[model samples]
Target: MDKKDLRIVFMGTPDFAVASLRVLVENNYNVVGVITMPDKPSGRGHKIQHSAVKQYALEQNLPILQPEKLKNENFIEELKTLRADLQIVVAFRMLPEVIWDMPRLGTFNLHASLLPQYRGAAPINWAIINGEKETGATTFFLTHEIDTGKIIAQERIPIGESDNVGKIHDELMNMGAKLVQKTVDLLLEDKVDAIPQEQFFNNEADLKSAPKIFKETCRIDWNKPVEQIYNHIRGLSPYPVAWTELYTIGEEPIAAKIYSANKIQTEGQLPVGSISTDNKTYLQIACMGGAIEVKEIQLPGKKAMKIDELLRGYKFQEGSYFK
Candidate 1:
């Protein structure tokens, strides 16, 4: 079958999914329709906001569907009318069997992590939080199980010691775009040999899960080793950032989000959560083994700024600490 002859229905909602859809459209693939989340009220104004995929699909002049209820008979009928031969999912919600099973060639998803590991909603965040030295993107056939279907292609990416979630996300977004195209190409030529994720593991205990991260999960624990704490900060940097409570003797505790930090690597340490700053360019917090040098931070009601800039406007008095 010609690559351009395969009618594809692409399902995605976020910017991550837009990359793959863009690649398919740019390559002149036959993407018959796009399905994204319904627009929702956002921000203080509560204005309706279209999903990233929806916005991009509009620019590309692709047909779009934003079904609030996937099981609605009307939605099912509309989807069937598209007459898609194949379906592609990326960063989208789970599909009922009725929808996934409708396509003749079946549905495939592009996941952020290697299969059998990080097989959940937030793979990129957990991989960085766990301090893994490497991770990758995978394209797989979707079945009854989520992220556990047969794999078609994968591309590995190295995680730098200082790399944050944002950096890794961008890298994988581009890599996933190419891999999605490759998966489609292989399917067109009938060259794909799907591999089950079970073949990679002998026991379930060996797998590392990528569960959803909540706000509590992003709180910084001062008792952990300096390296772990450093990893925690970077892993969540620039979004749902790692945070700590700054307590002053006479004032309410302030929530401070830490964005950029590094381990000081000292042999001796003060009490955990101890704060030492020159009132100029640096803020160091003591931990179990050493301390972390906080370079960028944001206090409540303030934008994220460098330690020096924050120092000029705000002061951490003597004996103040982060709890």
Candidate 2:
């Protein structure tokens, strides 16, 4: 079958998914339709905001469906009308069996981590938080269980020592885009050789899950090792950032979000969460074995700023610490 003749229905919602959809559309693959989340109110104004996928789909003049409920009979009927030969999912919510099984060639998803590991909603973040030196992307056919399907293709990339979630995210986004295109071509030519997830690991206990991160998940535990704390901060950096409560001798605890920090090996002993600073150019938080020198941070109702800039205007009380 020619590339232009294959009818593809693309499903995604965030910026991560846009790269794959854009690659397909720009390369002239037949994207028959796009399915994204419904527009909803955002920000203080409560103005309706279209998802990133929806915005791009509009720019390309592609057909779009923003269903409130995927299993609604009306929505299913509408989806069936698309006559999709295949469907591609990226950074989207889980679909019902009816929806995933609707297409002829079946649905495939672009997962951020190398499969059989980090299988869940937030793979990229968890991989970094666990201090893995390597991670990658995977394309797999959808199945009954989430992220348990047979893999179609896998691409590996190294995680740099200082790479944050935002950096790794963009890298995988572009790499996954090419992988999507490659998967489509392989499927079109009937040359795909998919492998089951079970083949990659022996014991189920060896597998690590990337469960959805919550507000509490981003909280920094100052008692942990400095290396662990550093990884935690970078893993959630630039969004849903790792945070802590700054405590002074006789005032309310102030909440602060840490965006960037470096682990420091020191000989000076201090209790975990103790504050160490020059009150002008640096702010360091003591942890097990060492400390973390905060590089970028944000306070409530204030923009993110470098440590020096923040310290210039804001004074850390003499006995201030973090918890």
RMSD of 2: 0.7
| Residue-level lDDT tens digits of model 1 in 1-323 | 98778999999999999999999999999999999999999999999999999999999999999999999999999999999999999999999999999999999999999888999988998899899999999999999988899999999999999999999999999999999999999999999999999998999899999988899999999999888999899889878799999999998999999999988888897999999999988899999899999999999999999999999999899989998
**In model 1, what are the clashing residue pairs, if there are any?**
none
RMSD values for the candidates in order, in angstroms, are 0.8, 0.7
| TM-scores for all predictions | 0.99, 0.99
lDDT of 2 by residue, 20-62 (tens): 9999999999999999999999999999999999999999999
lDDT of each: 0.94, 0.95
Cα miss at 135, model 2 (Å)?
Answer: 0.7
The candidate that achieves the highest lDDT relative to the unseen native structure: 2
